[model samples]
Target chain A: MGRHEFLESVAVADCAVEIEGDDLDDLFATAARALAEVMVDPATVPATVERSLELTAPSLDLLLYDWLSELIYVKDSEQLVFPVVEVHVTGGSPCRLTARLAGGPIDRTTTALRADAKAVTFHQFVLEPRERGWRARVVIDI
Target chain B: MKTLPVGDCVWEIPPGEKPGMRVPARIYASEALLARMDEGVFDQVTNVACLPGIVRAALCMPDGHWGYGFPIGGVAAFRADTGVISPGGIGFDINCGMRVLRTSLTEAEVRPKLAQLVDALFAAVPSGVGSKGFVRLSGDEFDEVMREGARWCVRRGYGWPEDLDATEGGGCLPGADPDQVSQRAVTRGRDQLGTLGSGNHYLEVQVVPPGGIHDPRVAKVFGIEQPGQILVMLHCGSRGFGHQIGTDYLRRFDQVMRGYGIVVRDRELACAPFGSPEGRAYFGAMLAAANSAFANRQLITHRVREVMGRVFGRDPRDLGLGVIYDVCHNTAKLERHTVDGEPLELVVHRKGATRSFGPGAPDVPAAYREVGQPVIIGGSMETGSALLVGTAHAMTETFGSTAHGAGRSMSRTQAKRRVWGEALIKQLGERGIVVRAASKSGVAEEAGFAYKDLGEVVDVVDRLDISRRVVSLVPIGNIKG
Candidate 1:
């Protein structure tokens, strides 16, 4: 299992989060979950819809960016708020990843959107492996 | 980095202060603003000075803050023949800008109906996360919007002919090629034409309060002569479409920059030669996104006019709902400017800055050419926003650029921790400002305490003669995205 927490000082105008996981897959899954919460309260969203995303990137850093960006596209295009995120990752020169996000169209009456995470910012973006696990920091433009 | 006071409200860092810097970096700010500026702004602005083919100096306006690549309120110009273009310099929301409209109604007339008007607008305009727009567009029609911008909206009866004339560049940036934009961008943006995306975006109904007119002469020329005159100010951008375009190019540029032998200290500042195939694609795609933003604001304007007409029992035209001006805060354009007494074409990037073309410049609309292009600078809804006019001094000092707003002085998380949105709403209501936000948390994040003093920032430029003050607008009604 992985965990994430919001950072207060990393970004002044947007939301920043730091995630920790036991491995690459856990790290990516944690990142997705963190990204999801930044936009809306996940607890209020029901896991009624399913979306599958697959992408490849030259670096793990870019792989994470692409995954989060793809989700933003889907969320904006379909007007869905994902509460559940599942990510599978394979580390290599060209990183590969697939995600399954479960959510549905936002019912404004029931949901309180915190912010519109417009895009993932590369400012101070970091992804690294630690002795015990992995850690990544992401700044999302709200 | 060591800096010297170059002029009143201006500080300069020589090229020797940083490795790879080709020119000096200048900060257009007051002594107090300079002292409080975050270190990241200094670092980022100096890094911008290192880019290949930079002209004169990289500039940080008074409202500057740290951003992805260039600082917010940053501007830089590059040689058209040899320089490069990076999405980082233009920001995720392409042409994310400000627009102001003048109305004949007075504060006295609007005050009684302020709550109803705000609520109607809040319901009519889609906002917040995962918000979709009312006007749906097919793939082909969306493409036309990219090419024709606000003109297409008028052609579709969403706007009037005169609206285009008040818009910057007639609301259509040239060289927008639909083919250059990606499918994902179109999918994300096709339906978002009239939406105000969350995160500091808003539509405010304001009035020129007594003593708010800083330059009475220019205010009269700009259709804001009276203190009680009402105005509608909208802040938004291209939405998901531009965000997708910026993301796509940032990744693409990172991959191809090494091939072009271009190196930037930060990967976020990735770039390729302006003349390269890669660069050409992004430029066209960016212009398309910029045009979409123009059309988006125009669509929102149409909705606002409809709501106003419905509320006040008069046609919008009869109410004198005319666009005063529309301006972009995030953009990169190729324009001809003189450098060191030589005239040359340059690609000027304004990330969180506005173009302040002074009086008599050919680009200024003929109606405003003698008075200067109107610049709308939005502050927090609780504090007041301002209307200003450009000056020739800006043309010489900052590539005709000026600050966009009072940049956030506190982090969103900190702001949320400090105040409860539920309480902030009541606080604002007591102050006589009606606010309707999609989310309470969003409102808290935008509390005036989290932002710098806009008056001080405006004073910096006013004193420097970059952008002169015209009128200050106090919000009577606001709908936060």
Candidate 2:
């Protein structure tokens, strides 16, 4: 299992979160959940709707960055708030990722939103491994 | 970094203070403001000084704070022929700005219905996360909006012709090649037009108390004619369309800058020469997004008018609900300015800053030429906002720019922890401000205590003669996203 928490004082007018996971797949999946939490409580989303995503990036870090950005893109283009994220990553210099997402259309009446996050920023972005697990810090422009 | 007092409300960090700095950096702030700024402000502004082809000096206004690459309130200019353009300098929300509308009705007449008006606005103008606006545009229509800006809105009956006159750049930036805009960007922004996105975006109904008029003569010219006059002020930006474009260009710049032999202190400051193919494409796309933002504000203005008209049972024009001014922050422009008495065409970037062209500049509208351009500074919901006029001094001192808002002193998470939304709403209601919001967390995140005192920020710019205060407006009702 992976975990995430919001950090204060990192961004003047945005959200910064730290996530930890058991492995690469866990980290990527947890990152999606954390990004979704920035907007609404995932527990309220019910995981009733499902979607799939596939992406390839030159590097693992860029892979994670684009994965989070894809969530924002989906929120805007598809008008979906994904609460559940499952990930499978293949190791290589060019990383490959396939994600399964579950959520539904955004309705103000059903889900209480916290903020309209603009983009996932590269300001002080860090994704690295600690002694026992992996740790990532991301800043989101709200 | 060593900083010395260089001028009135001005501080300078010399190039010798850091390696690779092409020019010194300047910050417009009083001693108190400097003390309150984060230590990161020095690092961020100094990092900006190291960028290629930077001109005169890198500048951070009184409201400066740490941003992705360029600090908020950051201003820098580069020579067009030899310079670079970075998406970080313009911000993710392209053309994020302020718009003010003046009403002929008095506060006494509107006070009884303030709550109703706020509620109506909250309902009519779609706001908050994932709330789509009423607009539905096809691909062709949306492209027209990308090129025509607010003019498209007016042609489709969203606004009046005269409204464009009061808008900056007449509500459009020319040479907007929609072909340069990405299909993904269009998909994100097409239907989002007219939405007031959450996180500090808000629409407020305010009043000009008799004693709050600072410049009586100029106030009358800009439509703040009578005491107790009610006004509407909104703060928002281009939404997801601009975000996608900015994200797209920023990533591309990061990948291409090395090929151009440009090295930036931060990845977010990545750039290519303004003459390069990459840069030109980005400029075109950015202009398109900026145009979309102008149209977004205009359409929102239409919604405000409709809501106000229904509440008052009068024609919007009959209520004298005309645009006073619309000014954008987080933008870049090509302008002619003189440095050392030498005329130069420069690409000026203003992120979390406002352009304050002087009275005689051709850019200032005919109606405001004598008093200078109107600069609107939005404050916290509790402290209120102000309408100022640009000064000749700003043109010479700070590249025709000034501070945009009261800089945040605390982050949103900290504010939410300190103040519960429901209680804050109750407390504000007791103080006569009617509050309507999409979510309680949204309200708490924007707690007034999280922001710096608006008066102090205004006083610094005022004392520097950059922009002079004209009228102060306190919020009577607010629709927060």
Candidate 3:
């Protein structure tokens, strides 16, 4: 019901939502789930391939973009859809992130495309941490 | 359902007509034609009214549509002292427009040779995305193209110098300073000249209908006919060169406006003062792009003439294939117009609109001064294209501008979802129109139903006497990119 709270409370853990676990992990996992939902139907993904990935970006906005774009690359090439369970944001030169994801072969009929994104554009995009949780503000290039 | 008469075909919104409008808006559509506009059309028109330096009104042409900063069929001439130039105004494919050619061949003689002629044209002209042409240029040669426009191609024997007479700005804007263009733009443009890039760009063959003939004597001189005479029309622009030029300038202008303390309601409407360094830089680059587009079309015309000759087994000279007119749709030109009583040098930005200067206008070419400048409007593949001439009415109404084409009624996604590409192709083929496209999906995106009926748009403009209808050309064959 509360869009901001829902976006903030999303977490990551063990490649799936840890409903009764740490807030940060659950938040990252939820963000990944949100991304996966937009890309394709998570229910249809076989979850056969276990993938571990890391990314670094200049800002939280860039971090979200890098994360989403990287996942999109994997979706296009590997035909894998990943629903995150755990995510750890570690500080580095830019900023580093580790995530666990799940996905499998793509089936177009059963999966509805949520958006027609040509490419991620650099418009008025921003990512920042809020008092309650992490928040990302971005406009998808459609 | 409500119409506030502005003047002639123009209608005013008067500030609070719609919500979120910082200023009033105007639409250049007759009451009959305005009724057929898409429901969301006013929304997009009002959205533009909220932009910065939008001047007296946010004007929409008969062919209006929802687009990024401004609607596709919208035009707003921002004040030179304060206005902004949105990339949305020029569009992603900068300077994309139409070039019409007249030929000696009548419909009867050309109809039989349609297949061979289409084949020749298809093979001769490179189409589709990433499609390259037989002609290629290096960075230096490309720079020459940016500076000389169609003349560069003519000097190389692509076409005759006379062809320049029928082109807007004589096929090259005078103030093209190549130094303002970026190296990346040069690189992208170097190989793309004379090539028809993908999506909505096309080379079409049509038969001229007899009845709507204007200046039959002159038409006779040009070899245009009454019911069925074959003609060639090319719709394209500067391609990657123009894209890169617009991109480079849009970003530069976006940042440059900060120095001038100028702010717009929308970032897409980013701009700098007309006299500022960035504004001059953008103008120079835009001109260079316009030149590249002119040269590209000139080369394509030459190839088309060659192919017509090869297919007809007669010299193209005898075939009477010559340029009727070449014009750009999205561009900003510097011209002198009387503001109050004294002539003032003004920067006129005509986006999705064509310059329709009437007879006796000094700016119009000498050959066409008697009949006025020929304005070619390329319609949907199913609907035929129209030939129009400038009218005296347009001079005071809309800065001598008229609607460019049948504006899109729906987005590509909606069109694709509703219509299948192959089915649309077959439908066209059944209607005696042959179409060749690079991507099937792309074709679906451009389905005739995706846009307003061009016939209606042209009719409104003609009825209003903004531009006089000269000819309606029904397509026989088309190759789309």
Candidate 4:
């Protein structure tokens, strides 16, 4: 299934989660797609544009926040919406991520941002590895 | 979704729910109301429970909603001895609140010209994103306004001392130190004073509903409807200035937090010791922002009074457009409250909450001491709002606090998708409620359905004994950003 379908399928009341390929790259890619699920018609976000992302952090959870925040910046500033199509996770204890993103012609019709999350708060934020893959539980400040 | 019985209407969040919790979170809601609560709200409150320096418990009100740091309906008291003040707790729009005005005009006179009055108000009130005002000020002048609060507006002839009497702390906190405020805040605030910034901010015309008041004497004192008497209520805040102050403080707090060994549950909850230099600076700047917000509302009142006079062909004073009560929803005030029977100076941070000083409280104005401080809760314009009075329970339970409004239920995107602004406006107009909006999008963003039911929210407060209902108000006209 496409990233959009995965996001829609995993939907919780206020959040959604997804598990993808067995690498850090794919994990970060899926995470971006999850956030995209909130902002627009995720299906419409194409892999037309490719961009490289790099983030280093002291903690794996903080790394995840920086990753999501990076994608948000790209979406908000560059108007590029992407369903993270690729991923690669590296580094120890505190992880680093490298990924590929795609999208184009940002949907101008999306007037109200899904949620203007104020910040990525540390409250109840956790990143854990499950039997199937990796999972993250982070609360966005809204 | 599980409930643990606490007092009459309180529910506890058992300590083991989240391992990191410093204290069990409690909610003030009836069983019936709790059943309908969105599960995300529970999760959010749980997150709040994990924050550091969270003394007592992370409390959520009946109006609780998912928010940045603390739930919109959340309340937590930190220990002054070893506590922190989070900007996320007070919200970005510091001191965003409501001001209710009592008018002599009966519902009879306002009904005829409600539409025109609403339109006039819409035009006069600057709203929407990046909305500016005609009363521009230089940076230096803006600094004075920030320091003085509503007194600045009153000094400029926007209002009188009587208005101050009805406002919290006479519309200005003494700790406001303009020098603590950054230049960016001053720039954003200079021209935004006297303007109603957008997103849930509005000017509403209301009529006290029939048979809504339990006390005829109290109703008469508050100028309640004899079936159709009219009142004006406005909700807004310090605008760009407040937003900038919040942003600046959050960064400063984040940088210095480690030095103070203040480990907050959330970075959004970043704070310094109340007595620390950083904390004092934030308090000073926050006070300035609160004062600026007070001045903003004060000026809006003057403008509304002007428009009312012109629209009705009667002087506003003659029409009894007197200030009833103005209260702040987001602020941290240094006050002495009895904690376990010992009086101590504490920095009370109220976010998405309003102070409801009970009758006879020394902090309350002498004029209102007998009746209790009026608590004006502004519901979304298309929904019903309420007027309540502080109860002794407030002082004992929630630190003299109560919910501010119908907390948001849906995200703006969801609301925009589900409700069209044009259709919503038409529906309201058909219902005899005239609405004037800065933009169609703004209207949709603030649709009543976008919020939790105010009736339900008010019921929780009344049932919980935090505040007692004084009257219910039905909207007649609306002016929104």
How close is every model to the real structure, measured as TM-score? 0.99, 0.98, 0.78, 0.80
Tens digits of per-residue lDDT for model 1, B81-113: 999998989999999999999999999999999
Using lDDT as the yardstick, the better of models 1 and 2 is 1
The candidate maximizing DockQ is 1
Q: Can you write out model 3's per-residue Cα lDDT over B248-269, one digit (the tens) per residue? A: 6655666667787765544545
Candidate 3 docks at the CAPRI level of incorrect
Candidate 4 lDDT tens digits, B237-346: 88767876776787678778899766665566777877788888888899999999999999999999999999999898998999989999988777667777777666
* Candidate 3 local Cα displacement, residue B95, angstroms: 1.5
Better of 1 and 3 by TM-score: 1
lDDT by residue for model 4 over A57-118, one digit each (tens)?
Answer: 76666677677755544543344667555666776866777777676545434333233222
DockQ for each numbered candidate: 0.78, 0.77, 0.06, 0.10
Between which residue pairs do clashes occur in model 2?
A: none
DockQ of 3: 0.06
Mark the 10 consecutive residues where model 4 chain B has the least summed lDDT: B125-134
Better of 2 and 3 by TM-score: 2
Ranking by lDDT: 1, 2, 4, 3
Model 2 alpha-carbon drift over 4 Å, by segment: none
